[model samples]
Target: MRIAYLILCHGQPAQIRRLVMALPPSSPIFIHVDARTSAAVHAEIHQLAYLRAHIHFVPRHRCFWSGYGIVKATNQLIISALASGEAFDRATLLSGADYPIKSQEHINAFFENAGDAEFIEAFPLHAPNRWSNHEGLYHGASRVDWFHVRFRSRAWRSPWRRRLPLGYEPWGGGQWWTLTRPALELIADVARKHPALPRFFRNVFLPDESYFQTLLGNSRFRGAIAGDDLRLVIWDRPEPPYPAILKARDIECLAESDKLFARKFDLYRNPEIYELIDARFLRRS
Candidate 1:
């Protein structure tokens, strides 16, 4: 089974190169380095990927954390990957900060067995026009219930209190996902069929998390979603900036998590973790 990887990242070209090298060699990788990245780093990212076959770089977007730009960048990658004419069995959306924690063979086998089951997390985001059993625990209720606007030198929130456009029961989830071709196609189709969809999400805070989730949750593919992204990301850490950077101390967790990949690692802070995973998980037969 073929897996197409769509990666979105702003920095850490070296580590991203490592991520590319670790994936199944024949799997197509479509990457988007944020447009706001330094010229040097951008050049370095392209140069580092120069020799990699089936690794395509798409148009970049100036991505901001918790902004709609991230979703745009991800969509660019997805569009490029799909346009490649490859019949990918699965498309795993990742960041350059992510690395596979499983062997390439195991990774391929997992997707082969996974079939059309989408690995994404989508919870019914409690909104004014929606009612959900997932209310008390949902933290992004405001994402859909309130309007958020971000522009150059301007950031504002609240106002325009409206229900989810087009009768969608708003759904929210982690941005990362591994989905089937049909799921991604459905999302693309929905966006094209309803131009207002993207515009609605463009004003929502962190559209990357809600946009796709809501689309799939409201589509025919809803029953097929597995409700898990399958990446071992640590969120409840006692620190700022999370999906806490994976350190050497997290290596044991990575190994034991039985996950296909893990995210947000920094070679600068914990180079040994990369070495350790390369030596054991990555390089292992």
Candidate 2:
């Protein structure tokens, strides 16, 4: 089965190249580099893609952490991949820092057995998480109109609130996922049909985490969801802004997990971890 990889990356060309090469060459790779990325990094990514037949670079978006830009970049990658008219069985969203824990053949075989299930981790927005205290307020609040809601600013001092459009419920989850083509098309259709949804979410805190989850959860594909993003991420604290940077000591734990990918690796700090993974799991060394 053909799989399309939608990678949202900003920097680290070497790491991205390793990820792309680790996957099956037949898999179409659609990369969206952050608009703020350095020209040198962009050139490096371009060179890598130029040498590969199926790897292509799409338009870049100015992505900011925990901002609407994340959702924008992700949307662009998914839309571009679908528009390419590729007959892909599934589309997996990944980041530059992530590496595969399973070989390409194993990943493909796992998906082939997965049938049409969607692999997304999600929960209701009001599910008693530490991210928000006034979860119900999100229902009738225009997160965009609020002041200083983007980035590291607090959400407590919002100016005003507006109700979400009818027939929409708030949902949130981790940003990465593996989805069937129909599930992705459904999300794109929802965004296309409800232009206001995007505008409203543009101001919401970490919209990337909530937008796709809310749409997929409310749609008919909810039943197809596997409820797991299939990525093994380690957090230093229960509610940390970023995941812990993986290292050599984590290789065995990563291998033991059934997860397909692990994230937040730094070549400068833990190049050996990746080499070990490649030798033990990916068999590319």
Winning model by lDDT? 1
Cα deviation of 58, candidate 1, in Å: 0.6
Q: Name every residue pair that clashes in candidate 2.
A: 140-162, 140-163, 141-162, 142-162
For model 2, how big is the CA root-mean-square deviation? Answer: 3.2
> How much does each candidate deviate from the true structure in C-alpha RMSD?
3.1, 3.2
Q: Candidate 2: where is the Cα deviation over 4 Å? A: 128-148, 151-157, 237-241
Q: Please give the lDDT score for candidate 1.
A: 0.82
Question: How high is each candidate's TM-score?
Answer: 0.92, 0.90
The superposed Cα distance between candidate 1 and the true structure at residue 52, in angstroms, equals 1.9
Clashes per model (N, Cα, C within 3 A): 0, 4
The superposed Cα distance between candidate 2 and the true structure at residue 283, in angstroms, equals 1.2
lDDT of each: 0.82, 0.81
lDDT by residue for model 1 over 1-285, one digit each (tens)? 889999887888778887888887788888899999999999998985676778888998988877888888988887778788866877999988888898888888888888679999887777433334334213367767777777752546666677787898889888899998888888777777998888888877778888999999888988998988998988889766877988888888998897888987887788889899988887842
- Supply the TM-score for candidate 2: 0.90
